[model samples]
Target: MLDSLLPPLNEHNLPYPDTIHPIVVHFVIAMVLFAFVCDTVSYFTRNPKLAEVSWWNLVFATVSIFIAVIFGQIEAGLAEPYDAAVSTLNLHSILGWSLSGVLAAVTGWRYVLRLQNKPQLPTPYIVASVALVGLVIAQTYLGDLLVWVYGLHSVPVVEATRGGQL
Candidate 1:
């Protein structure tokens, strides 16, 4: 019936052979980076125009990050990590959840700044934005470890899992 159009399962038994989390999360990362860059550059250049751009980017990023986290949680649950990969997966999951909250809080603060009489971000908000970038970088490293070091969805690992040899 409806399953006629569905793709066959891969070695990992996923209906579609690819990981969905990475594709969505990369967009979240890019949007957050672009937002921070626009904000920082605008702060220094005194270009009010860039503030509008930055605000929109942050808004989109905040919304997109939740989507990324949801997909990440789903994919991670399906990952079936081997022994050595377990810790990295756990840490990445925790940080992914934390980053979603942090991003939402920062976006809320940015909204407050937009509503201010001056319509300018404060120094503390800027500082927090920079810190957010740092946290994102750390999260990126953990993700890399899972994909590169652990090879979570790599074909060989997938095959092993499917064969019940993992």
Candidate 2:
């Protein structure tokens, strides 16, 4: 069983370890979660004193999204061609990019609205944050689907059989 489980290491076609991909995904997810938490807390607390700090949270999350996009691109580049799971990976990449763009734009808009003292800024901020959370959920789900359903670039398994070396 142990022998069947461990594929011999080779130079030409080295398999990427499963652990790294999920770590990257989790990092991105954490960014989104932190953004949501900060936004929610700020909204409820409504302490004008913390306004600047709360805004910084969104800024930091936006930066993290950029980092995640880089990591996602690297992961995709490392993926093997002919893998049936590429479809989900492709979809994940597209959605992740779209989410990052929207988040960045919204964050910038919020900052502008803050400077302008726009009366309706709060409502738009709330709406944008909710949309970001929804996008995060969708992105996470797509990642899960790639792993569980598509099995993209997963380690190959070997089965033992009664016949000779099968």
Candidate 3:
């Protein structure tokens, strides 16, 4: 049974070399950033039209983030972190979960603002969005460290894991 689970692979390997988390996550990151930008610009210009763009982006990102986090958790679990990578992996995991909650809460708040038919986002909410961006930047850095620095699911790591040597 275990043998069947662990099939042989070549350098050409599993659909992609790494986990699918990053592929999905980049969408969330882009959406969140763009949403914030739209909101900020609309706020300064007092053009409510951009709010529609921001709201839709936020909605899509809210849904996409969960998908990204699910894949992230699964991939993180499967990662065979070396001693040096363990701390980084743990930080990345913690930040990913934290960001999920923050993103959901902000989405809910935005929904409320939408319901209220406000002309623009409240200053506080915009500030919160700025903070969210900061956290996201930090999260991106950590994720990069894991994949680029630690090489979590790189072809070599995958090969080692498949061979029970990771």
Candidate 4:
């Protein structure tokens, strides 16, 4: 029955080098973390200069997310489709896209607020940043589960047998 939901695993048809996939994932995760850290710091410091820097960080993050999304789609295509793992990947994708929107909104709001000479961190700014951080945590967990629980890719045992370690 599980087979009905999940495409059978194919070890020979990987979309990219295993090394490449993990590296891209790590890089993308780092980008998101950087954005989250910038957001939090800007919120606490209430420094308009830091907010400006955070806005640039968010722009870089958005660009990185676009690249990450492409890589993720490729990875997903390489994995079994319709399985629980893919389902979780789907959830992660939704949350990731939502986060991009939220980040964009926050950046725009900050820009406008700066233009208006009201550079103080507003209550909504704090609330949105908090929500974005929560979403980042959830998305990170989903990414971990996709690799750790689903066995969609090579496990450590297989890697060791293949004379490699991930």
Would you list the C-alpha lDDT of every candidate in the order shown? Answer: 0.86, 0.66, 0.86, 0.63
Candidate 3: residue 48 Cα off by (Å): 1.1
lDDT of each residue in 86-165, candidate 4, tens digit only: 57878877876776676667667756766776646677766776776677678778877776775556544344434533
lDDT for each residue of candidate 2 in 28-68, tens digit (9 for 90 to 100): 57766675666566677765444555567667778877877
Off by over 4 Å in 1: 1-8, 117-119
Q: 150, model 3: CA deviation in Å?
A: 0.6
Best by TM-score: 1
Candidate 1 collision pairs: none
Q: What clash pairs does model 3 have?
A: none
lDDT of 4 at 125: 69
lDDT, ranked from best to worst: 3, 1, 2, 4
CA-RMSD of model 1? 2.8
Q: Which lDDT value does model 3 have at 66?
A: 90
Q: Residue 125 in candidate 2 has what lDDT?
A: 76
- Predictions ranked by TM-score, top down? 1, 3, 4, 2
Which model is ahead, 3 or 4, in terms of TM-score?
3
Q: Show pairs that collide, candidate 2.
A: none
Clashes of 2: 0
Q: Could you tell me the TM-score of candidate 2?
A: 0.69
